[model samples]
Target: MNLLSLLRGEAFKRGIHPPQNKLTAERSIRRLPFASRLVVPLSQHIGKPARAVVRVGQEVVRGELIAEADGWLSVPHHAPATGFVEAIELRPSAKGPWEQSIVIKVQPGSTQEVQVAHPRDMGVLNPQEIIAAVQQTGMVGLGGAAFPSHAKMSVPKDAKVHTLVVNGCECEPYLTCDHRVMVEHADDLIEGIRHAMRATGAVRTVIGIEDNKMSAVEAIQAALMARHIPADQIAVQAVPTKYPQGAEKMLIMALFGVEVPSGGLPLAYGMVVLNVGTLAALGCLLPRGEGLVERVVTVTGPAVQRPGDYRVPIGTPMKFLLDYAGAPAESYQVILGGPMMGQAAASLDVPVTKGMSGLLVMRGADFCDRDDQKIYPCIKCGECVAACPMGLNPSLLGMLAAMRDYEPMGSQYHLGDCFECGSCSFVCPSSIPLVQQFRVAKQVLRERAVA
Candidate 1:
């Protein structure tokens, strides 16, 4: 980065600052007890579903590969516990659909330790080898997108990556898993950054943390000092605390003062951004030669009794997690992530996937009186326009969405640029579900294209 970039503070325009209800920010991550039956979804990521390799009734050890990647776009699945495969059939997903899943009944004395036969020397692995190792780990973006990590590292042959932008900005309200990872797993995170740098062939890395996480910044700085890496190679920079500041484009702009071209990727501009949690986990897992079978999830919200960060094994049922967290049996809505951009869970039967960062449970009364409950007509207010970080007219897009003019929303209005961060909906005085409309419109457009 140039002197001008350094002088330009990490500030992005037009983002709403909702209450930072980060209940577990100070809480250390504790491991949850294994649920009786774990439901491993084959399609836990954004790509093709994994092909199951284990038969029903087969015994599997923890971290053992249970499924193989179906194609280049897919990721494999690992057993989250030492258990017997109970069944392989359709199971309820948080998205309101039944998906092919492997049901594992936990063994009587299943241990938390993974069965690793050998540890690999990461120092000897080349870039391609590192990427292949990432694929073997079945790693994905733990930042909730769940895009395969290996795929991100597999930059195009023509692209030349200069910097590996590390996203430590846990800007979403009530989600502190990434924050805790940065603070508690600093060594692993630095190691992960090194792996990412090697994989992406980037000479330097910049960790853009939100100002709210000063402790995380300090922790990363200490780690870097202990590692003896030059500041030019990797440095931690604090960005302003703002909603949607954690978005890739927003963080990129905040750090480098460069806006990714509309409908283009950061890779196009010689950068590869990876989430702190994803890299930390990769750093820890790659050496062990283990697959991603567990992750740290923030179980918090107004409705949770034992609110804190919990190291949860993947495929643990929502009901089991909630029960462990002392959630009420009465009617309460569960959002699988933060309140801003997270979606409401369709059912409690959904098993925790690689994408889940936090489980936010709230009673209906929590939002009963909020303006969002009752939809109102757009008042032609420019609140959304001012709040949108992408500089798109959300009011116009919302109007277009209501009219089902989806094509123009993309073609003329640049709907594809909107990352759906929910700032527009938060600031809309009329309580219009502008973000929800955009989501539906985008989904409809995808379906239309397929048709």
Candidate 2:
């Protein structure tokens, strides 16, 4: 059966088919020049913030560790470019909070070559050593999760991981960085998979690419053959293209036909999933003994003039990027990631982080005026129900949210299951902002639980 033929039948039910808007899918990745100054947020990852090791006025080279991992949950931060530390103070973060960050003033005429702290041969390292080495590279999910890669690869001693699922499904619209990585970095991807297999003890690896990217599938297959890797040990499988198909649970279902138990993880099903970009970077960095200071980001959307994928340094500010990408001088909305799940930029001062995959700039004229439209009552239309990929009742959840009945929204309605994909909000005829309501409800519930 062809992967394209299985699009509707095999895909998870109730995902919206939004316009792909992949304008720069074919654009090759280009390097973005260093910003005058960069801000390295200590709290970019999900866990404890890294502790700054460099003092103000200290000169640092690219890839040199500026901060140390505070704990096992945290990952160290590396200098994105050769510069002198101007300050280590509070800086604007994408999440609308002031976080402790190391500000570096780039030295003019610096080549910005990465200074490898130490090089290691992966051939002699044991599984534990590989897991330890993953932390040294400062790797994270790269798919917007920002979860530490080392923590994810380290399974409990008693548990057995059967498969390492590689996510090549760049499901989010306007984000082609991952797609470009799959096409151009196939060799690194294969090498990364080998290390991941050894680390997690997965007998085989299955890379799930959306059918829309058949070229990626072919590229990966060719790389596997060129490296003389067997098909059974590593395979590229194209699942149907759908929104949120890049999500771990949905991708697992599309590949193995099994659902991860609710409130549990893919690990519960004896599987571990990693993003292709994350693994590809790991493949290139681990052998060179370098830290992650740069990533491929898709700079695109209507407001962008030179829309393409750029190899962006970790701490490059949004304003610098927008200027380089040739955005209009007029008003526009700049989003840090894709429209579906990305957040509106709080400020252009916020620098790009490890998890940021794309920068989407939308002209004001591109979207409908939300404030101008009146929010009508839901007529109990089943559109939201039909569009929700998680199979939750957005109508009921919205009602509960309006009534301030937050407890039932979670205990009874399973509001915790919502991943905020905005599918329900997109299809709502009443324009009630169902996803926003769910986010507020979840936050309230969490606060109450903490109280």
Candidate 3:
């Protein structure tokens, strides 16, 4: 679990190194005033969409359930603030498309209110009760996956999970949300890890953080000591400073010295990975009997005048959020998540959902010149291959994608294993858009498979 070893660990061999632009790490978490209207997307999580129970023009209280899950794969959606259900219709979202969501207009100047609850001591709840409470709270993976945390904890009957990998590596360039959470709320993290251990039946948990943040590691270590949580059962280990080290596969490999077999989850190797923010929120909500209403989102970039992290309520509008965060309108390109795999916002009308972890407003100076950002032919420099964490030949994939040979890309090059971390594009000497080309190729192959 030594993250800073000059000789890299067993699994993660080579990943590109990008400039870590964590501007908000120095600042503390802040809060923003309630936006006028909040839009809660039903399909924020990965699986099935939640079904809305409230109709338009109906009034709902803060923390009231607006949408409930229809199946085990989905997570419920709760009211972030007191408001009237204005509409249930298609709206702009982070996926760069319109999605069906509940639109609620806040009562002007409504008092900031939260649900009243008693903290059920952690020891009081049994295994099943803890899992039920987590599901009721609408908790999802906050590390940008947005998968239902409850579902993740519910390991299959046959699969034996030996190690619970807690991801603290905010390795994505320009994102410090998880880092800030670990530094500021370390106590909650330990509590969260204990809860996960109870749910998963895992004997031990390992907190894997990148070597970049010595401060975070110190804070987490202090928390474990203060709580008298078994230091050996749950240890804080610093991982190497490399792109894609934050990925579940790479982190599990770094910690256990095992590679996840091709086309398999970490569970295939007896491991279950969860994000620190997701675990911290579980620690906060499950004990208090309160549902998920807000989350700490990183709102920082060069285009932002006052960059910092904020405890933003879910359903907050992107436009209103940027305005409150002092984001310069005409000076930056805005995206909903980290620079490596995040999608750009076609319109600021999109509202924050469970999946929107960071609002990156990068300016022109933070990017290459528009006209100069041209794709060049690869000269076979082998940098992309050397940088690929999965060891796939991006040069070959890009060639196949250009030639419209989608079959060979997946069958021969193992395209399904690529995590799309953008390491190849980051290190390509020819400035070739290797990641984008692979994405296009994968999509085409998937469509063909269904057809």
Candidate 4:
């Protein structure tokens, strides 16, 4: 370890060290049984919504494609279980809107065996072929950004990628899915890294894990040794455990000591970063030519009775997950990721999508005592200034948002760079929801632009 880096707190400036409530980190991942009904949304990814291929009453087997990609930026969706399409209608989504969805009713006694497509030897596949195969898997960034994996891997011709940064830093509190994936699926992750490296023309791979997760680091290093991959080609480094360190820019900064330019991507730095869970899913699916139907999710909180990492199918309802996890009977609040940045679910009926990493349930005092409902006046204390990773003046931004001065927030204050990490809100002593105000301000600006 570099003494200077250690002294500078792992060298990435301005981040908080929240209590890592990683309850499920030590637990082995357990597969949840198929739900009786699944509501598969067509627009799970960030691009255009998928076109439904299977109509109502159409029988589909597990892993069979029920929807096709709408465009180059979209991804297909597969049946999570052998079932008949019950309906194709609008359903509530976690995003607080009605979205087109395909509802399926599982067949009685139907074995949920996934019917694999054309399996190929990944070693022989070229870069384009690997990318095409990855698109077929319906993989997305499982680290809460549901951007299509294939799109992310498809580097532009103008840009040259030199490094593939594998993010194994599950920095969010109470989320252990990525940690478990790193610990148990290290080999698969390595294979996926190789594929990603090929797809992006990256010559070397680096897995950045939080120092707190020594087990995952050890597991990945051992896997690399077993595969005889050279350290020069692939290396695992432990970064400081800090909130939002798993963010691509932050991770890249911590690992390489370079800052990605504001309003830019890792591609600009000749690098591509991938989440550990996303790559592991690719490693498991690409070789078998299978679609992503399930993912490992951390179901934990103070209200959960059976807290653990679970292999949950896509489109599994939050209600089913809560029931299985033995959520408290009383009214509870459920968020779809970590406490810091996760969105609170508007309805339990919404199905788990590709971006969801954890199902956090808080009850009683933990739920009702939250300061979310309280909005205090900004004291201009400058805590948000210190907490902001992007070095933006969130206090000024918050003040501008209060005055409905949306345009200035973007034009002068660099509002687009916020990324809504919730750090400002977390550190705000006045309980002002700075991130939320920024979100509204940005939305207003977008609407204005359209007008």
Candidate 5:
């Protein structure tokens, strides 16, 4: 039942691959000039919104906490650039709606000067103290989960986490932000993993990457070796190159040969997986005792003139980033993550946050060519069934969704478990938009529940 034993056996399973289109994998990350104004949404993560501390016209320095964590499940927000507060009100965010936000105007020619972070030895701190210190830094999953990092660290005392699985499997095509982070900031990642081990009391750690990125695997392996961390204590294993392999459950199954029971957390399998980027951010924040005000982001696609990864400050606008990346003015669609699972932006003014790992700009020519975006009936060819890693009948669900028979789909067919990986749509020859139908179905059910 122990997870370590599972890794010794067969690892991860199936998912479809889209074009990697990774135009910036080899490019070094650069820092963009602070936008003239930042619209930092208070609720960037999945939990409670942080409370704003600074008022309008108040001056704030880089890394200064502008909003304090409102609860254990939230993270604080800091000034990414030295600036004066312009307003604290509802603003457009990347999530497709306006949320309460703090806006700032960068002081003319502001330079990067981080506020003095009060640091201390990790050995001197207790587990709770370490958790408190982590909360102070405003860290989140950074891999797009955007769950508060402190909340993740606070596992129930009754549930013991044995293996801290570091997911280096950036399997989503076109998203090399995690890959670049691992290659460039391996030291920080190692240090952060250690902090995570301490936080969770895990006896061992393993960094799992898909085979496509041998360079990242080599880099992390070398970092571990130099640190004198034994091979068995901290490892670097190459998982198969499969889409959704980066999905926490799929990665666990692949790297450790352990299946996370349907709808179960890895803790049930005695494992806790953290993104490589999460560890890297922790490595930077834990020692300095600062907040997560900025993060590394990938801005790439055919529509972009300058396609590469850049360190974007939290609260920068989507429009600014697209322009900064030299995106074509006539681009057709802009996605906030990878094509398979990324959300479409409703407006260009929405600001970036901890959860946005990739921004993809696709022109009309880049996507599948279609006149009128036609929808064809599924021929029941069983392709989707074979393609589904979870082995669900997506054709039936797609039909149900189209017919507005959502209740039967939920009650009789188990619709809630779909994570919307877009696998079925990828395999469907008719291009029935199976994933799109599922999205609408889930949304309708969710809204009905709330209503």
Candidate 6:
């Protein structure tokens, strides 16, 4: 069946369809010039922070390893530009915490060319070697998770992986970095899929794109055909364009008609899902033996004058990017990713880390209008229940959160299954921040558990 027909036939229930403000979807990615200073944080990934290897006053080239992985779960960090190490000090992070960072001052007139290490022939490498090489590239899920790519690619020996699901669904509004990657870097994405399949011992790979991006599906299909990839080995499938379709569980359901068990991963279903942009980075970096120094980021919103997809260095500050994007001088809110899931930037000085996929700048009026909306008591409305993709009772959970009854929310209501997609909050007539309350409850539960 054609992709359009396939999308019509299959869709997960209970997902809100937000306006896809993909203004930069067709804009080819342009490289942003090196910022005068870069603050490379060691804890960009999910696990232990990397150990700094370069000292203050040391000169480092772009793509040069500046920090080493402290453990198997951690990934190394590389210099995003050729520069002198000015200091290793604490800097503001996107998460509103001061993190240890390596500050680099760009050298005058230095051509910021990446110094590639010896390239490896991926064909000769065993699965273990492939995983190691992926780790060395300092890659993480570029889809805002920042989970280490190598760790994700590594499947346990007992489990068997049958399918490699490549996620090209840029479901978030105002974020087209992944869409642009799928369109412009199709070959690299395909190559990355092959490597990921081999690493995980998957028999076949499927690229699940949203129907809205038929152009991406076409590009990927052409790349697969040009490479003569066998039909059964790889195929592109288009799912419905819905909010949170980019989530691994939802995408898996849409494509394969299977639901990932609650509190389990796609791995439990004999599949491994990867983001297209993440794979594209691995495809490009692994062959060249270069560390991940840059990524394509969408810079757009009401306050941006030059909204487009930009290839920005890892440590580039949000302020510098806003300036490059011609952001308005007046007050504006900067979000590190898409509106629904992305966090508001604590400060403009926060550097763009691996997890950041888009930079959304909204005018003060636009931001405050939403913030000023009053929250009312839940009217026992079933809108949140109807909107929840996981089929969890968000209304009950919200009520539990209100009474500080988090344990029942988790134990009885199956609160762990909620992915915080904000669909309930979006559709709520009371304007209650249901997702926010859920997040706070979850965090409190985690803290209590740890204590």
- The global C-alpha lDDT for each of the candidates, from Candidate 1 onward, is 0.90, 0.88, 0.84, 0.88, 0.83, 0.88
- Using lDDT as the yardstick, the better of models 4 and 6 is 6
Question: Each model's TM-score?
Answer: 0.97, 0.96, 0.95, 0.95, 0.96, 0.96
Candidate 3 Cα lDDT to native: 0.84
Per-residue lDDT value at 365 in model 1: 77
Name the runs in model 5 displaced over 4 angstroms: 8-11, 369-372
Q: Which window of ten consecutive residues has the lowest lDDT sum in model 1? A: 1-10
List model 1 lDDT by residue over 302-403, tens digit each. Answer: 988899989999999989999999887347888889999899999997899999999888877765467457778888869999999999999999999999
Q: What digit string (tens of lDDT, one per residue) describes model 3 on residues 38-144? A: 99999888899999989999998778899998698888888888889999999987777788999989888776676544467768777777787788888999988
Candidate 5 pairs with clashing backbones: 6-256, 7-256, 11-254, 12-254, 137-291
Which regions of candidate 4 fall more than 4 Å away from where they truly are?
1-9, 367-374
lDDT by residue (150-200, candidate 4, tens digit) is 999998888888888889888889999999999999999998998999999
Q: Which candidate is the best by lDDT?
A: 1
Tens digit of lDDT per residue, candidate 5, span 184-259?
9999999999888888888888888888788898999898888889866788888878777788878877776667
- lDDT (C-alpha) at residue 178 in model 2: 91
Mark the regions of model 3 whose C-alpha exceeds 4 Å error after superposition: 1-11, 116-122, 369-371
Judged by TM-score, which candidate is best? 1
TM-score, candidate number 2: 0.96
In candidate 1, the residue pairs with backbone N, CA or C atoms under 3 Å apart (3 or more residues apart, or in different chains) clash, namely none
Please give the range of 10 consecutive residues that has the lowest summed lDDT in model 3.
Answer: 1-10
Candidate RMSDs in Å, in order, are 1.6, 2.7, 2.7, 2.7, 1.6, 2.5
* Model 1 Cα shift for residue 35 (angstroms): 0.7
How many backbone clashes can be found in candidate 2? 0
Alpha carbon lDDT of residue 157, candidate 5?
Answer: 74
